[model samples]
Target chain A: MREVFHQSLEDVQSRLVEIAELVTVAIERATKAFGTSDVTLAEEVIEADQVIDDKAIELDELAIQILARQQPVARDLRIVVAALRVSASLERMGDIAEHIAQLTRMRFPERAIPKGLKSTFTKMGEIDVQVANLLTEILRTEDLALVEKLRTLDDQLDDLHLSVFEKVLSENWQGEAGATVDATLASRYHERFADHALSVAKKVAYLATGEWTPDTDSIAVIVAADLAAVRENADGAEA
Target chain B: MREVFHQSLEDVQSRLVEIAELVTVAIERATKAFGTSDVTLAEEVIEADQVIDDKAIELDELAIQILARQQPVARDLRIVVAALRVSASLERMGDIAEHIAQLTRMRFPERAIPKGLKSTFTKMGEIDVQVANLLTEILRTEDLALVEKLRTLDDQLDDLHLSVFEKVLSENWQGEAGATVDATLASRYHERFADHALSVAKKVAYLATGEWTPDTDSIAVIVAADLAAVRENADGAEA
Candidate 1:
């Protein structure tokens, strides 16, 4: 039974890596297609996303089965849970790729992005692919050291995302409302792709460390302030 | 042991509703604050989000305990997992509310939205709060009927969001770059808040039905085309 459970764990690990690889390819193609306005390639990325979704569903089922059948305790249980989250993240990355591809498809023949911003998007695509490849490695190894690099990549993506706004704000920007909206959304998609990658890495690290760090922690202070506000409201009601 | 597990499940459920209620309040105030430029109210909502986060973490810890201790199978297992997902969705809703509050705080004493878009945003905030309150009921009852209403509410938000874009695209858009970005992001946050609520409703429906529909599917055709492309590449390599 123990050996069988270990094999199941190995199966999940392999599936995660499979998903990571597939999504990495998706990002690469989507970015390439977005940068060049390749509608055919964009269509391909959009269609490939279904496979990623199917794979994610498969992984989720496998994890749930393992949880029910093996009843893994402690770290083993966390591994299963984290696998589910990572699959969801990877699947979302695929959807982001699809959203990017959809933009390319939407503006076929005419470039979705104006000429001035193409180079900026090119940089985003390059960094997106690099971060995606690193995500593949992170899933495979679960090495804590690699997570920091993903963070740095995410920061760079943020800077690129910010630059999109800078371009929009520039006096030289001649694009209409449609172009600006598309460019903003496209930049957001890439930035969020990296952000999801960062989130997945953080979850994996949590699985490794078993530490709890709530992103929002000052609720107690907020609660006290809230009570005071309620009193003030009561004072208003009386008045 | 079964009784203990059920109690723990009940405990998690209670915590979920608590989080939902708190988040509902957060949304109400954040939007009110954003609409009114009430810096005090905005600060209150911002600070209250920490409490929402804390409650979500507490619920997650409880659900994990149930999983590890009871090792619930099949339906019960799904129940615990769904609770975890719901907690996550609720926590994210708080973050969205916090973001709305942040925008209000960002432009204190000045409106985050322009006069042209105020009526539309007013409508968005109303729909947001309504959907949030409905979500609280859905969590309490899991009544599939409420899901459709939530979807309708979400559609209303989408329409309002589209109007924002329309306003931005119009020749009369008088807001500067910062305002445009702020308006776009605020619209997105409200839309996503509704989207998340819709997602939770779907999740609850899935828990009830045992159906396996991934929200994003139809990637198979893409994969077949992708395979064909790979083969073409291989053939070219051989040539």
Candidate 2:
């Protein structure tokens, strides 16, 4: 029975890693589509979402089965629960990537985004890659120190988001409607991507600390930067 | 040990319901402030958030302890895991309410929002109350049906958010800057509140189905409505 339980646990972990890998690929493909306006790549990202979704369901079932069979206690139980939460976060990340891909498909063929905003999208893609890397590290080592590093990375994403907004609202760009739409969508995708990354970090923190911390400082900093960016943009418009 | 686990579970449930109550109150207060431009009421919502945050952490720890001690299997394990996710969603709801209150404070003394948007805000408040009630039912009965009902109510909130944006971008609203700020913040708060409600519903679904189905049709509907509203508003402005 113990051997069976151990085997099931390992199976669930491996499946989770597989789902994470799919999510990373989805992010990469979605961002590539965004940068190149490749509708075919976007379609691929959308089509591949089912695999991630199915794997997430498989992991949940495995976790439930392990709990029912082994009745894991203490640390073992925490590990199972953490795996469930992390899987959900990863699933959400996949969903966000699909969302970005869908937006790309909708706004394509027109080259709606200007050159300036392309760099913003590129920045977002970089952040998405960082988030994917963080998930890999957490799964590989379950190390809290590596998870702690997500805070600074999340802050950088926030800064890039604010800068994107500032550039969108400025007169140098003629405030084109297409530009605004691209900027808004790009900002939202980055913000939400960072949010999922933070969710993963929170799960890792729980594994390490045995307690859940809200980590509001990161959000506060984002909000503060948002307010400052809006103010600066408004002033620039007035001038 | 079983008795202790049961008691802790009960404690966590009670606190969850309490937090739900606070979320409803904060939503009500923030909406009222939006209607009347009452800074004092908004301030109350902001101040009350600390209590919500504290309870969230406390309940999270209690749930973890219960899991560690009881090593609950199957349904029991699902219930504990659901509780943890629900608490996180509730905490996020509290944060959204506080965010709206902050917006109210920022727009004070001059009434940034016009009278035309009051009905829409009131409708959003109604949806908020419904979501809170749905969560309370979830805790009381663990009824999957009632939780499913929340998905529709979330759509209603999204509809209300669309109308708010329509009013903002319409020519009838000559004061573009303040209206834009008010509408942006209002839409964000409403959308986020609905998102949290959906998160709670997802937890209930997992508890019932043992599968992460990611039923987001309701959100898709809401997003479609937003796109239509934005288009109509822009067209009307051009006319």
Estimate, for each residue in B1-239, the C-alpha lDDT of model 1 and write its tens digit.
88888888788777888899999999999999999999899999887887888888788778778889889999999988888778878888998998888778766667877768899999999999999999999989989899999989987887677667767656667776556767777887888899888878888889889874456533323332333344344335546
Question: Cα deviation of A130 in candidate 1 (Å)?
Answer: 1.0
Error of 2 at B37 (Å): 4.1
lDDT of 2 at A174: 54
**Considering only chain A, what is the TM-score of each predicted structure?**
0.88, 0.89
Candidate 1 residues lying further than 4 Å off, grouped into runs, are A212-239, B217-239
Q: Model 2 off-target regions past 4 Å?
A: A1-6, A112-115, A143-145, A171-173, A176-182, A205-213, A225-239, B1-8, B37-40, B105-118, B141-152, B164-185, B202-214, B225-239
| Collision pairs in model 2 | none
Residue by residue across A1-239, what tens digits does model 2's lDDT show? Answer: 77887787778777777787888888988888878889889879877887887788778778777876687877677788778877878888888888777766655664535567777778778778778877777776678887768777877877787676566555565544434544665576767787887887787777678786765634743464466557555766788
Model 2: number of backbone collisions: 0
Error of 2 at B9 (Å): 3.8
Local error of candidate 1 at residue A214 (angstroms): 4.6
Q: What is the C-alpha local distance difference test score of each model? A: 0.80, 0.73
Query: B15-58, model 2: which lDDT tens digit per residue?
Result: 88888888888888877786678989988988888888888878
